[model samples]
Target: MSTRTETDSMGAIEVPSKAYWGAQTQRSKENFAIGHQPMPLAVVHALAHIKKAAARVNANLGELPTDIAQLIEQAADEVIAGELDQHFPLTVWQTGSGTQTNMNVNEVIAGRANEISGQTRGGKSPVHPNDHVNRAQSSNDCFPTAMHIAVLQAVTLHLTPAIKTLRDGIDQQAKRYEKLVKTGRTHMMDATPVTFGQELSAFVAQLDYAQTAIDNSLPAVCELAQGGTAVGTGLNSSPGFAEAIAKELAQLTELPLRSAPNKFAALAGHEPLVTLSGAIKTLAVTLMKLANDLRLLGSGPRAGLAEVHLPANEPGSSIMPGKVNPTQCEALSMLACQVIGNDTTISIAASQGHLQLNVFKPVIVHNLLESIELLADGCVNFQKQCIAGMTANEQQMAAHLENGLMLVTALNRHIGYDNAAKIAKKAYEDNQTLRQAALDLGLVTDEQFSQWVRPEDMLQPE
Candidate 1:
């Protein structure tokens, strides 16, 4: 885009004659055919933050003479406000060099700046967009900074709120269904009695711990590598410029942002990215566990243990009529698996950061942003479809609890272990109820038996 105002002589169908990203966009379109899910919104947020910070910095310095800087700022504001999306063109796929993306941002900003100045589309003269606006910055620092800023922004804006909604729904259910008895299962077999609320409360605990795990990493998330320049040496940056720029970014983003203590380490490796990715993977683990529970609880209306019912999203099958599937639960499980896999990609990519800079940024951002987006979307859907609509089947729960062989646990408290074993075995063989067999053998008096068989007492142990 910083080149000429035209497309590559040989690339995709000509959609528009105007050019800013110039031949790079055309070349990218022709080369990488990766599907368009759109660049991550975190990436968008980051770019906007860059524009805002630049404009504010220029304002503070009051030295930028041309109207171009101000105009580029306005265009960036439009992009942030959800307008002019077509203009932010660049393929998600490119060579690891990031030339296409850097040029893409540079040209778009420069051209829009030119437009504001009533100049030609490809002109950068009056303000020299890259020189004046992107002054003292490098793609290496900006992209990684954007990645951190974007992730932190999402955790604050979207992920945290969604997780709260999810946790609150389950927490309410835990309290609401605390009195409802259900058959607890382990290894796909009925184990003992438990309150349906208690089982749900376990998931609530998982969500809480996961929330804590993510929240605990906020400090690391806030630390940034903005001053790292091309290789973290603070190369052309002035003394305190890094700090001032970081402060400007913090003000613009409203995040607790800071410059990294060791710019060298920040640039030479991506350990922080790997750590954050692991945190995200931990969240996926929590979600997968929650989804598995919901799926199991909603397993069957007929043959399976239907302890809780989930809202039917659609006709479960085209061929099998009258069957409903746990679509939301399934989606969450799938997303969790994908996120876990994304973390692996992130880990590998971050670890492979060669000597000075990592060429793996595009891939790292791709995986990290995608993982976060899925997490946000999945949590919102899971809360709405699965958790909100889930209902405790009190009758089914009571029946399962009453009919299970786990009631033998109560017999052990009343009679000796040997006597309880004998009673359970005889009841199994005789096809008689534990109470009936107990009465026949006098292992428990009828009054004692009537007093001791409370499921609540069995689960809570007094």
Candidate 2:
């Protein structure tokens, strides 16, 4: 490939002629050949938003020339539109502070801006990366600010809506099964009678509570760390730079973003992200339980519980004849496990913040974004493939309900607890119905047993 020499503070390097990144980006790319997990484009777009807002704010404050600021804004807009995606090649494993990725964005925007202004892409002539594009900002602040913006947008625009869609779909299933009475299990054994609708509604309630927790954790994520340049002193930044930039970013992203009240804490501690991760983890746990329950309820057609029929998206076995599996639920459960693991990574990374800055910002944000995307996509896929087409096995449910020993629970208030237990034991021992056992044991008349052992009556309080 053709190459061009690009210069930065650390001398010069040969960059791909077609590439828009500069010397620092090239150096970082060559040095950190660790993993293939590239920095999230969401974060890159967020950084572009920050640079555009910063440029406009700097120009308005008379800190940067209007033409230069406009050029940076144009390039940043292109990045935000994903026109320059190939230019940002840094990985998440580079520089935990995310400085390399930040510079990669800065360099790409500068090179593109320079090219737009009738200059070559290598040299920082018409639009220097640092002075013109990244003016009045430090990687320390820009990275965390970008992290917050990316996470906030992703959760708001993707994860939350996906969760709502799935929750609503499950709720519809619940309503459809509301009157279908089934046997309930406790400790993996028959316990009592419940409507299939009630069982599914519990999943709906869990999702609602988890989504509320995720929503509640977002306001803190809206606090940006942009103006806390270097070490949070706002040393070289103009007086109103922080507030002005926050306002500009809010307008650009249509989020209720604001400058952090304590720049020091914003730069040093990533408590907001940790809190959001915890909430996402809770959602993952809820999803895990829901998926497992669905899997169990839909376990088999002949050999297992088979209380419900999951969508048979694909054939389950290669050797077995005519079998299907709960692939969507399995996939969703695995994704939940991954998100839960990502939460652990985020928690550990967040706790490593030393004095003025957290060097684990990249890992923290990477795991957080990964969890959000996984959950969002997982929910959509599970809803479309599994929950939307799920059906209740009403006949099987009724059969289970009729055969359950726990229905003897209904006889407690009438025949006394000891008599009820004796009747249940006798029925189980003789493989007889509760009414027959009660009649044989002389515990109650058939009419009395019928009146006392109604499963539907036991569904609610007397």
Candidate 3:
């Protein structure tokens, strides 16, 4: 492989001639080749924003030359646009503090800035990575700040919209099926009759709660850890450096960003991220329930309780001919499972902090971002491929309603619970429906039976 020598404080190292990274990034890359998955694009974008805003802020404070700052901003903008993505080649396993990835970004932006300034790639003269690009910032502060920015941007751009789409789709289904009465099951056995709209409305409400949870955590997520340069002391940074960076970042990303109120707590803990992860897990739980219920309701066309018909996107079996399956529900269920597992990882990582610095930032950010992306994308796919095309099997639902012995539940309010149970028992013993059994048992006339046990009226008595 083609290589060139670059030097850091640790002295000389060889980097790929084509790579924009420098000595430290190259050394760290060699040290940790554990995972193929690079740090997420959202993270890279957030880092770019951080670097760009830092350069601009430093320049305004007379800490850096304006020309150099403009060049760094230009290069950082390319990174933000994903034009220089191939330049950042470090994995998530490099440094627990994510210092390696931060340096990787710094090196790439410096190299690009150097290129713009008409200098050699590895030469750190005009746009030195640490002195200029990463001025007044430490990996400790920048990484956690980037974590918050990435997650916040991801939730705003993807998760919220996707969840809204799913909730609205469910609401539309509920409105369409407002009058469609179906057998409601408890403990996998027929218990009572409920309108299809009412069942779907429950899922709608769940998504609403999940969305609210995510929304509530946004304020905490907006608090950034950037100002606390090293160990939350803000020692080397100029006064107002943190606040200025926050303002620049907020203006650049169009997000409501702010300086961390307590740099010590921000540097040492990841409470906001943990809270957000919990909210994401809640969404995953709701999704799992929704998907499983859909699968059960659309189980079999010939044998099982096939009340709702899901979109048949794929074949159920390799051998079974002409068998369709709920592929979207399966995908959603699998994603939900993954998100739940990611929450465990995030919680553990969040707790691993030891005073003034959490070394597990990379893992936390990686897992948290993955969870958000999976649920967001999964919701979009499920909504389009499954929910949008789903239909109610009115005939099948009607057949189940007629055959379900639980319909006698409505009669309990009028004819006493004992008589209702007896009528249900008689229907079961004689292999007759409730209507037929009620007529033979002299419980009531046809008109009275119909009036007392109407499924439509059973929905909402008051």
Candidate 4:
């Protein structure tokens, strides 16, 4: 392949003639071959945003020529639009500070800027990668800034809306099933009575709590490390550079971007990400439990609870005819497990930071973005494939509620707990409904049993 030489502080190296990246990015490509997975597109987009904001801020501050800054900004716009995604080929296992990826963006933007100015791809004249494009910034700050912008944008633009959709879908279903009483279970045994709406409301409440936690965590994530340059002292960066860039980034990304209150702490640890990941982990647990409940409720139309009918999108067994699986619930539950695992990885990565910089940045951002994307997609899929189409087996629910000895819970106020337990045991021993057992044991007349043990009434406190 035809190649061109690009020079950095380390000296000259041959780069692919057609490639947009320079020496450092090419060196990183050759050195870090451990993980083939490319950095996530969200991070790349965020890096583009940061580069553009910095260029605009520098130009405004008279630190860079307006024409050169305009070219860099234009190229970064293209990168943000994903027109040049193929140029970033480095793996996620590179330098802990993500310097390679940062340099990769700088080189690509500079190369594209050079090309736009009628210069060659490897030319470093009017728009040198480090001196011009990466001016007043270090990989130390830019990388974490990119991570913050990416995570906040993802949560605000994708995860929040997806979760809201899920919550709304569940709320609509809850409203629809408000009167569908079923036997509620604890310890996998019948305990009391609850409406189908009440069960679904629990998931809605969980989603609300998760959303609140995520929203509360955003201010910290939006606190950027951009001004910290190499080691939190803002070395080489001009006075007010951090503030200007932060303001420009906020306007550009429309996020609540701010300079970190403590730059050293921001660069040395990713506590904000850790906190957000915890919230996401909680959401995953909620989703897993809800998915399992759906699967259990929809299990075995002929044998198991079968209190609800999941949409039959696929066959459950290869040999068994007319069997449909709860495929969406299965997929959602599996996704939840993966998200939970990713949270653990993020937590560990967050704890691995050294004195000045966190080396685990690539892994942390990658895992965090993966968790966000998985959860967003999972919520959408679960709503589309399962929740939106779920149908209550009203007849089965009524039957279960009528026969459940747990409905005696409502009678505790009238018959006393001891009598209620005795009635339940008597019903189980005789394989009879509690109503019949109460009648046989002279616990109550038919009218009293009907009034006291009504499942619909049992759904609420008397």
What would the TM-score be for candidate 4 when compared with the true structure? 0.97
Q: Which ten residues in a row have the lowest lDDT in candidate 1?
A: 7-16
Highest lDDT scorer = 2
lDDT of 3: 0.91
Candidate 2 vs. true structure, TM-score: 0.99
Error of 1 at 313 (Å): 2.8
Ranking the candidates on lDDT from highest down gives 2, 3, 4, 1
For model 1, the stretches where C-alpha displacement exceeds 4 angstroms are 1-16, 23-38, 55-68
**Please, what is the whole-model Cα lDDT of each candidate in the order they appear?**
0.74, 0.92, 0.91, 0.91
For each candidate in turn, the TM-score is 0.90, 0.99, 0.98, 0.97
Instruction: Please report how far candidate 4 places residue 181 from its true position, in Å.
Output: 1.3
Give the Cα-based TM-score of candidate 1 against the true structure: 0.90
| Clash tally for model 1 | 2
Cα lDDT of model 3 by residue, 138-226, tens digit: 99999999999999999999999999999999999999998999989999998788999999999999999999999998999999999
What lDDT does candidate 4 reach at residue 306?
94
Backbone clash pairs for candidate 1 read: 1-20, 1-21
Candidate 2 vs 3: which has more lDDT: 2
Clashing pairs in 4: none
Error of 3 at 74 (Å): 1.3
| Residue pairs in candidate 2 whose N, alpha carbon or C atoms collide under 3 angstroms | none
lDDT (Cα) of model 2: 0.92
